[model samples]
Target: AQSPLALRQNILSTLGRTMLEEGVWTFPFTRWIKLIASELSAYRDAAPPDEQQSLRYLTPQDIHEEIKHSGLLRYGDTRTRVEFAHHTYQEFYAALALKNQVDDIEPYVDTPEARRRWQGVIVLLYGITTDRVKLYSQILGYSNDYARIWLAAQCLANAGEDIPTALSRLQEALVPSQQFALLFSVGLACRQLGRYPEALTYLLKAAEENPASAEVQFELGALYRQVDQFERAIFHLEEAIRLRSDFVDVYNQLGLTYYDQEKYEEALTVFRATTQLEPHNPYHYYNVGTVQKILRDYEGARESFRMALKLKPDYIEAKTQLDMLEKALSTGVVQMLEKIPMLSKMTLEQSVLLANRIQVKEYQPGQIVFHMGEMGDTFYIIEVGEVEVLAPEMGRSSGGVINRLGPGNFFGEIALLRAVPRTATIRATKPTRLLAISRDDFSAVLSRYPAIAHRLAETSSLRLLRDRQIGRRVDLDRYYDPGYIAELTRQDRVTVLMGDIHGSTYLTNAIGPELMVAFLDEYLLRMSSIIVQAGGAMDKSLGDSVMGVFGSNPDVPGDESLPVKAALLAALRMREEYVILRDKWKQQSPEFAHSGMGIGISTGKVRTGTVGAEATMVGPAVNMASKLSKLAIKGRTESEVYIDGVTRQLAGDSFATEPLDPAYTKKKVGVELEAYRLIRQK
Candidate 1:
């Protein structure tokens, strides 16, 4: 929330203290900030006693005087409620206090009220240590205790520490027993990230520090079970149970560990004990039912599953299990409507009732279930037999069969979740029975069940991000920077030209980032040079998109049509320049070579000058031109420039163009404007 200016000043002012580095200024500013104002002697960063008296905020009048004079801060004229100039300054103070391990920082981190109020500031504190892990270790590792220690320890654990060398040095110097919380946090971080061996070592060290901590023991036990050390897992789990009898998580893991070791009776005992500990939890019954079902105790499993459903009516997993049990009454083979991971979180009783709406269909061998490019909403679970997954491959005659899934394996969520065309074909490989749920039913469930919808969104988001990161997808990017200089001349006929690079993600991923950035830098430079030559000003840069303004630059004449002419010339030359770039990169970085961009140009009369805080652009031209830039890119590989009728007419036969479909621009832009695609320069 703090302005960049205020943030810089806060750092400068604090660091400006000559002796603060001697430990005068608290690293994590806490309740001590107020105390420091009252008694500066103890709080001086490192100032000698003689000079400490010169510190600010010595009296009420002095505090009031500085607050009014600085002009950087604005607040109610109350001493207790006065705030810093910017939110960033306050956040910086908080981080500094924590780094110094100030005693009073616990309220900032521990108290819910303070934490929520300062959540924005507190969240950014982690970023401080991101690139300065060494500095963090050297300063907080040795000097700080409690709040700072465990927090910093957890920070190191979350990162993908490809370089364990730094960790080794930090670990060797620290005594885990001396700082129980710090050691425990490090162990938990590693365990969550699947660094099981590293987690085990840290947990063991932490356990040695405090054998009485059931939390530490539980973590150690669970981790041991994960890595297949059943006996050791049971030892620590039992220790945790001895320390805290009501540790439901401990019982759950103990039961699972016993189950993994094929000690069925012992596993059942532990699971039952967990149910006794937390009778209301549906998951406990579900766990018991799962074990019973696997052990061929169908009757017991049915009872447990029924109890789970009774406790939580919307429990999809439990409901699925229960439904399967009912289906198994005749054949003894489990059946499901669909296996959507997030569906269990949804509270759609109506959708659950609609589960009966699912059709059971049989497909003979070689019958196509669904084909690629066909949009579908239905999800299918294999009730019996097998289905072959055929996905498009570059070198295959028949689309390659990627998978042959049998009973229990389900398909169709990808299309249903995204509402997109099927990416692969599904066909029956044998006499296959499928339990199907329609798209309408799925959508109804998602709309009514927010928790399930959120869970599904998380999955889709991760997948989309993964696809974008690897260059297989190009996501539309939009951004606006705050703090604009309001400058607009009302009569200025500005011609705006916008260019967006298409398929950038693919090229960026194909070539390494280093080369791709270099290519973009050179490419943008070439386009920018053309604009500068035409006396146009680059107004904004939105990732692959560029915004340029004409007719307003001091270097250019005040002719209203001058900008439009310059923009057109620049746009035409960009296409020619891109051809050269394409060929060069094709030879130099062949794999990354891809087709170029699209342009939208429009000329309209508008206000363009030094603007105020509420500054804004108002004109039909600005929106039209921006929209056209997006339109020009539609379904085309090679570069193309589309201009509004005004731009084409203003040029007066200087360029060759023909009117495009009026309805296309009208439908897209929501304004009836004569649009033309610029073919070439006359």
Candidate 2:
């Protein structure tokens, strides 16, 4: 039996053939009936005389009856025009018609109007067209529109057909600027076709071009998963999630990867997280239930499965799981409590007893669970969602968040251990659920299980020791929100570009402080604008220099070398703009004309975070960039732009560079640094 989708496709394909034969796309219902009748008559006439006599030819009335019954076509409000039930159906049939009649589709795609009208047809054709290489080559030849070209590439990638010839053609025609998109598309195509080695080669190249692309990271992670490279898969998936936190699909894929490795606990955590991200998604709930069932949390599994069913009443898989869970419970199967750090030492009986006394509590976002200085005796373990630990005394009006806790994390342990006031305020950062145990219940379990008490005491003592150590250091929460601080604190590969006005002091003396300040402001403003436009963040502006960092924003999708490229481009633009500015300033004052801007760029890993209440980037690259900027001083070097070896390497063939004399750089910079003179972009 054909599925509904297949049946619809068949019917649409037939209608498309009829439309093509009659050379009409849209028409009145009466005209459509005539076309169908004419097509049926032609088919009967082509048959042998004996067969024609016995053949069942659909008349105009028969065709009209079938069309009405199929519900695949509908009349316009005026009852004059007839069209496909859905636009997609119209596009699907049109593509089939074009594939049947046209040998070369480039002519149709070359014009904007044709491309727009038949855009869906072209994409659909890529999937079913014979000689996809020829088709791709034809489209590539005429289409200069990147979006249109990319659309074709995406179609070819998802065609699920072997495309070695098409891939080779695309590679040969690859434009330097479009390299990332082309490589990524080809890699995706190869991956879909199960050509893992080819897919990896292209995707790796694409990644080098733009490491910040969450899509590329996701594809790489999925590819790694297919190749059974669990660790690599996890790394890429985690990076994808980090690059785009709201990527619910990546979370699900990451969860599935963990499930493949039989790491049920990790899988459960990831799957549960997806539920928080997309609360109404039945699939996420089903995934969570599956992992819970494996981890022997029957009750949790039952709840998850029930939720899935509630979201999608016809979710058969969820219904089956819920039924099975109920049967297991009826048979007296033990549903163990989740293994938390504090409860790890408790025996099954003791854990179950303690679990029964544990009360589940919910909190809305921004709702305080406990206030600082309030006497508290309840310990909390986050069941689902996040909470912020705030310290008002550490000083922000909103209360400084000292730490953030998520699922499986516990706090308020000090209150459980002794009669003390809450050291910090606990507030829900999102819709949160926590498992709470009163001191009496916890103490009862601890009294019955000596080992549990000892283990918890050791853990609590370590936490206290860490807290005391943290107290001695500067309170980071006082300067920035803990969440912002955590986000800012990371080690990452980045490109740092430093630009400084040469002979600024001389200009200051010649122009005077009044004119110098005004000229400097305009100069800095223009330079800063150029840097930002090139996708670099202004780190800071010191006395006569402006510093910018590229690839600092994880949210900005680009290749690995993108930061280098952007930094280099900004440097070139700055020089060009400064030349124009210098010419303009020369008309006003000779002092400003003589002062040239020198730019230095370096690419390497850096530690970025809040320092002394301000965001700062600290690494060898930062130092190298500063030193190189000095080397590029107008009278010191042949060029106004200098870059270190790492930056040059990342810049690749996209930019032109000449190696600086090593001995000369060493003598001037007081370091044995390999440097290059930025010539120009190739």
Candidate 3:
């Protein structure tokens, strides 16, 4: 029988020939990487447990050293080889770490005993030292290990550069269990570099491998937040907190989720718990304080602020709160004294002291303190029980109560702001206690508390905006400046590639072309409407596919990045539309049923210009976008949308992506092509 090396050599030679004939360089690189992998495996198998250290290559850096000796970097720049090495190492390390083999890791931090045990591992984990640098440089002087060099190139890619080219060179790299981690890191870097959709793809890969990872869930949460999907944010954040209870910041974030839903009491409870967990965290205190204020617990709010200041003395928020409390207290007092008509003859200074001592008055049901339209100098609060403001004469015989004002709830304060008659009749729903603040006293309090004055102003403004009743869907063409798209795209470029359903001739033959056309027409119109309303512009429609651009300024700001984002936003909207439409149509017509369009999005610089006759304008980037879309349409990839490295960089924390092998597809453009797939939690 031939030796293992001989057998491997035979396999390598055969594989190499096949790859060369196929014109796929990745195949050859893969074979080489695998051969090296086999050798390392053999070394591991033969070495005794205790004696393994002599030849032990546990960490990625050890592998890097071996590869450096084998001359892998000779084929490319040291930078590229270093990157590949890092990528390979990270893939392995992350996997090992996930398995809780931290014992195998050397102490990367400065320590005594740690340095003696896992020197190579520690150095690689923490990064280059002077001695380590010298060692690697010496190894590079000679031809390094080809396998390790490839790994180094991958590492460089993880560090913050393009790894696809190097990955293409080493196609046969082992798929470690930590593949998700490597992909996630790569996706994150891509996002930092302005590749939003690409990051979404790579991070999605990470999410798939470790569906329970808090990091991945948090990432999905962030993406949903950007798209204003508050419900989705709640879902992801809840999951993240569930998975990792000690995530620390997630507690406050969860609180915000509740707050956004208008579950004020729930939000307050969440924030209170967060403050308890992170007592020293000033922000938590601030959040709790805000919620307390909203709930009308003036004393409780003051105490929360004081606690916040105690934790951090320079807290501007806490100081601001103090000023507001003082104003409210003074105003309550002055308003009380001014309310008593018998005390109208009292001097201002005496009135001030007397007002400060007035206690809140309790009212019984049907007790009339003052009737509607009667002159009154005071506002009322439900100090103990419930009160109702009724529009008695407004159509109904009795009247409709606008709100249930309960204990701690205040009303009639606006009466102090404006000297208008009561807008509605006020009556006690149950036994109620009231505190009054007269207009003159309120003004005097404002003079003392500037911060409170500002708070009151902000509250008033917020109320006005809320009551304005603007419709949900605003016309982007009118109020939104076309140039704003360019600005948004420049800040965050996204991409969208679209593909139409093909090979439906068989389906149509079975179901009739009229049915097929009807189905397609309905879906296309529904999807188009959805995408456009979501602020995406259709780039063009090619039969079954509609390519669209996001972040594009119709007003012609001429920003190159905008078109790509416009495309991506459109794609997302189309995807959502497809889900609903598919369910409805499938319910109605099973034979003529159809899957949604395939989309591919790669973010990067592509020429955007008008082509065609004077009567028509077309964009070439639209042509480039067909690569991923066509791939999806042909079922060449599992991913519905394939994004590129560039798009991943743009999306950042908002979305994640997965790097994929070059996807192949046949279309008007033709042939196999490299593409990245975008991934995010549904």
Instruction: After superposing candidate 2 on the true structure, give the runs of residues whose Cα lies further than 4 Å from its correct spot.
Output: 1-14, 17-31, 35-93, 96-124, 127-162, 174-177, 333-682
Poorest 10 consecutive residues by lDDT, candidate 3: 468-477
User: For residues 1-682, could you state the per-residue lDDT of candidate 1 as single tens digits?
Assistant: 2112332344333432211223222222333244334333334555556644555335434443454366633443544433456656555555654544443334454544544454443434555544344443432444324344445555555444642564565556555433565566677667767788888887898788888888788888888888888888899999999999998989999999998987888898899998898999999999999888766576898899999999999999999888866666544222243234434333224334546567788999999998764666787878899998663332122334545779877776544554544545789999999988787766776777676677766665444334323321111111121222133333457787778776787876775444454355445545554554565665545456666666655445565566678889888877776676667566546664565677889887655433354333446676777788777434635688899988988888789998888888788778787989898989
TM-score of each: 0.33, 0.36, 0.31
lDDT of candidate model 3 versus the reference: 0.51
User: Model 2: per-residue lDDT, tens digit, 1-682?
Assistant: 1112332344456676455445555657776666666656765667678766654643556655566567767776667777777767777787877777678876667777767666777778888887665676666553235445556666886676557776667667655565567677777767766789999998898888888888788888989999999999999999999999999989999999999998999999999999999999999999998888777777898999999999999999899778867765763212324344334445445655676687889999999999765767898888789998664431112334556788877776555666555545789999999888898988997898787688776675545534433431222223323343234336367788899877788887786543454355446556666765676666645556777777745676657787789899889988877777676666557766667778889887667655477566767788889888887434822237899998888888999888899899999889888899998989
Number of backbone collisions per candidate? 23, 7, 72
Q: Which residue pairs in candidate 2 have backbone atoms (N, alpha carbon, C) closer than 3 angstroms, thus clashing?
A: 209-559, 209-560, 210-558, 210-559, 210-560, 211-559, 211-560
Q: Sort the predicted structures by lDDT, highest score first.
A: 2, 1, 3
lDDT of each: 0.63, 0.71, 0.51
Best by lDDT: 2
Give one digit per residue, the lDDT tens place, for model 3 in 168-258. Answer: 3322342354345455555555555556677667667767877877877776666655556778778888888899887766767778777
lDDT for 36 in candidate 1 is: 33
Instruction: Give lDDT: candidate 3, residue 479.
Output: 23
Q: Give the TM-score of candidate 3.
A: 0.31
